[model samples]
Target: MFSERFIQYIKYEKRYSAHTVTAYQSDLDQFMLFLNNPGNADPAPEPEITHPSQISYHHIRNWMVELIDQKMLARSVNRKMATLRKYFKFLLQEGVIETNPASRIQSQKIPKSLPVVVEGDRLTEMLDSDEIFSADFEGRRDKLIIEMLFGTGMRLAELLGVKEQDVNLHDGVVKVLGKRNKERIIPVNTELKNLLKEYIDLKKNQNFDNNSFTLIVTNKGAGAYPAMIYLIVQKYLSNISTQSKRSPHVLRHTFATTLLNKGADLNSIKELLGHANLSATQIYTHNSVERLKSIYKLAHPKA
Candidate 1:
């Protein structure tokens, strides 16, 4: 009952994305299960914790220890801890608990790693090569998917949420529903605008029962899902780049890095990528710095 209310609060009041709400609910459920069965590792029999008030710092610590024992990454464990901290903070605010048990717990320090980005030259080669993409509907859709992600720097979820009406061909702009359901307009190039018009015309000719009004759809005319989008990107990226990480997010990182390398300001990139804060966009600067260092090493005779 308490969990349900908490879910509702985060969904409606906090306006969290469905994906985020589902993750929070999963974390809470796992914690509850842990409380009920502290596990067979303890030799001494202990009472099962039946209520949130009964939870203590020791219980939370033991859970973290178990997570570590399972070889889960520190970043993932910290996310779970964050979920607990938020839940307990909510409980304390509602007067259900006198204090937050997760208050004293500290998150694990995570090492910063630069995101992988596809080179601009390679992307240009693949997109421009007629042999890479077929003339069929599937080919057109796949090409558009790559162009959209690299061109707009939109998240996979945002791309999936795009609708036919969200695209303005004449204005050469596409409306993207970003994180927290915030909408942003991204300009499309002439080539992409023409592609969009062609794709829409082809889609209309097929006339499948696509009542959802989603812009991207499967061969069956159903809305595209995350896994489907991932596979589509992975298959095409494998043909050109040898990056270990070839997901849609890599394309987003590629978009930001390309812009930064070409002299686009961080603030402008942040707004284009729909980042709520500049910090999230600053990661791309590291890639830009690395590229500059490479160029300097190759060109400067003094070095």
Candidate 2:
């Protein structure tokens, strides 16, 4: 009952995306299952927890241990822990629990890995090479998808959520709805603006259902979903990049890294990428520093 109310609170009041809400729901369900069937998994089991109010730090620790024993990565386990922390905070706020069980729990320290980005010259070569992306409707749509990610540095979800009205060809700006439902306007390059206009015209000529107002659509005229977008990005990126991580996010990283390497201000890149904080955008600087080191090594004559 409490879980249902929390789900509703996040979905309606917090306005979290469906994907995020689903993740929270899954975390809660798993935790509840652990509480209710603690000893069922073994010949001798522990006592079952009957209510949220009865949960303590010990139970939370046992759950974390079980997750780690199952070989879940530290990053994933930390996300689940965050879900529990949020849930307990909600219970505390509603006066159903006197104390938060997850308050004292510490998240596992995760290694900092720099984002994988395709080299700028390689990406430009692939995009500019003739016949790489065909001229048909599907081809045009696919090309636009790649360009949109690399050009605007928008999240895949934000790109998929774009509606026809969100784009302003005349003004050369695209309105992106970002995390926590924050909206930001990102400028579109002249080349990409023309490509968007062409894609829009092609979409209109398809006579898609009137209810489908999304800017990017599947071949069947339905709005593009996450899986389809992933596959599209993966397929195109494989053509030019040998990196193991070649998803839409890599393109976003490429966009930001390219700008940073070319001397764009960090704050400007933050706004363009719709990052809520400057620190979130600072990771790209690591890429810039690496590039500088490479240039220095190649040019310096000292032994």
Candidate 3:
């Protein structure tokens, strides 16, 4: 149906990250489920909405309330709402619907939350400790995972998409396909560059066929998956950080926060992180400010 067409539109034409596309599709499915009656219908006599024309602002608002009532976080609710927004827009353009009913709906208000960052020194110590990572391929590979995420502000998807051909060790830059399939060149620091070289040599010597396409791989010489990378990052981060969140995203936050704290401009960090706009990168500024506030509160003398 049109749902398949809508999904393919986002996946190919929009070039959204696979994970994001999956989430959007799932959200759309949930919305359709909400439309279906009797089996899993709403308390009201909501008809099985088979067409985009049947969806109205009232349905979307009710769905939002239902999601909130189900204890879905505001951010999650907002994202689902975003799915409706995009879906309706596409339907309007495709002539499946005349008006975008999902338009003009305000998003749920969310509290401002700063990105979580680990201290630079703590990360340095963790990466340097011989006790932390082993000398073997998996160990080094895992370590490089942490290093690359923290050293560069790349998202997990971007890191997983790196290919051997994309690396230019001599030039000290690596190409990454960022959100929406946008290509951007990120500079590799000397430390990360050296680590990359070592990792590549190890992979080649080990003769892993997976290294033919992707840079990071599983122990069985296959391309890595999201859960694997998440587990690897979570496993190593647990050693150094006690934060509730220790996923690859935390390291990305650390990377951006580190750059902002180090006086790097927002535009530079935006370029490095492959953000489409500066506002996304500007959150690091808030992170930096909050960090400074914490320091002042800890270090200030008698008031």
Which predicted model would earn the best lDDT? 2
Off by over 4 Å in 3: 39-46, 209-211
Model 1 Cα lDDT, one tens digit per residue, 1-303: 278889999999989888889999999998888777745336776777666787888778889989989999999999999999999999888888888889989998888999898887899789989999897889889999999999889999999999999999989999998878789999998999998999888877777885658999998789999999999999999988887899999999999998888889999999999999999999988987888899999999986
Clashing pairs in 3: none
RMSD score of candidate 2 (Å): 1.6
Tens digit per residue, CA lDDT, model 3, 42-118: 56666567677988888888778889889999999999999999999998999999999889789989998988877
Error of 2 at 88 (Å): 0.4
Q: Per-residue lDDT for 1-303 in model 2, tens only? A: 499999999999999887799999999999888878846344566566567888889888889999999999999999999999999999999999999999999999998989899987888787777778988789889999989999999999999999999999999999989888889999999989999999999888888775588988999899899999999989988888777888899999999999998889999999999888999999999988888888889999971
TM-score pick, better of 1 and 3: 1
How many residue pairs clash (N, CA or C atoms closer than 3 angstroms) in each of the candidate models, in the order given? Answer: 0, 1, 0
How do the predictions measure up, each by TM-score? 0.96, 0.95, 0.94
**lDDT for each of the candidates?**
0.89, 0.90, 0.87
Ranking of all candidate structures by their TM-score, best first? 1, 2, 3
Could you report the Cα RMSD, in angstroms, for every candidate shown?
A: 1.4, 1.6, 1.8
- Candidate with more favorable, higher TM-score: 1 or 2: 1
Task: Kindly report which residue stretches of model 1 are placed more than 4 angstroms away from their true locations once superposed.
Answer: 38-41
**What is the model-wide C-alpha lDDT for candidate 3?**
0.87
